[model samples]
Target: MNTATIDTSPIRILRRPEVEKRIGLGRSTIYLHMQQGTFPKPIRLGSGGAAAVGWLEHEIDAWLHEQVSKSRVSSTRA
Candidate 1:
């Protein structure tokens, strides 16, 4: 018998565009949620950089899971 395993280490750091595509959210909406403290805050990839560029794949995955749980709870209540 053979089995498959998954690697769970935090690897990829997705940029804003990739994150928007993955989460189906607009640029403004993403920033809005972040301001509300309901989303993962991006990390600084470099020092003294004008453009913000950094994100943890794990954090995004966790946010997705939270959204799924919220949906499930709302549906159960309805």
Candidate 2:
């Protein structure tokens, strides 16, 4: 293990509340989109076989930006 060569950037994990607030989607809607393969999926946390899960902040941010861009493009076309 080369400690000096390791990149130490932290990844922000957004829990349900934060994710919902950021994406404007409720728990059920988020889960539904996930199942439909239309949204980013959450990552499992910890190692105790727990059911805890969260979405990466950056991923959610990208999704929101993409959605806005698509909306603008379609509205312009119409």
Candidate 3:
């Protein structure tokens, strides 16, 4: 493996509070979007007895970008 050629982007995990803070959406809204297949689903963590969930930072960033693009397009049309 060529270390210099490898992709080195860090995998950041964002919990519900952080995700909501970054996206400016509440917990129920986020879950609603997820259920509607309009948002990226979280990655489940921890064991069988104690499970946790988090979203990939990159995925959330991508979703944000898409929203921005849509907003720009809509505004330009208006």
Candidate 4:
């Protein structure tokens, strides 16, 4: 017998405001980074002609960690 598979991972989505709070960036900067492909793009949270969008919590966390890592690495080379 075959059964339907389900994803059990804990997924937390953050809205634009929360993202800004966590990353300490303004809305325009976030959009700018997204346009430049330097930031994680938000995924549509609403369907059926809705425009709501949010970012995956883990992606934002990873981006923050990467920024810190890059800053440290760059400083060490000086």
* Tens-place lDDT digits, model 4, residues 2-78: 79889899999999999999999999999999999999999998786778999999999999999999999999999
Clashing pairs in 4: none
Query: Which runs in model 3 stand beyond 4 Å of their true positions?
Result: 1-6
Provide the global lDDT of candidate 2 against the true structure.
Answer: 0.90
lDDT of 1 at 7: 79
lDDT of 3 by residue, 1-78 (tens): 655786678899999999999999999999999999999999988877569999999999999999999999999999
Q: Could you give me the TM-score of model 2 versus the true structure?
A: 0.82
Measured with C-alpha atoms, the lDDT of residue 59 in candidate 3 is: 97
Q: Which 10 successive residues of model 2 have the least lDDT summed?
A: 1-10
Q: Give the better candidate number (1 or 4) by lDDT.
A: 4
Candidate 1: give the clashing pairs: none
Better-scoring candidate (TM-score), 3 or 4: 3
Residues 23-48, model 1: lDDT tens digits: 99988999999999999999887778
Evaluated with TM-score, which candidate comes out highest? 3
Which has the higher lDDT value, candidate number 2 or candidate number 4?
A: 4
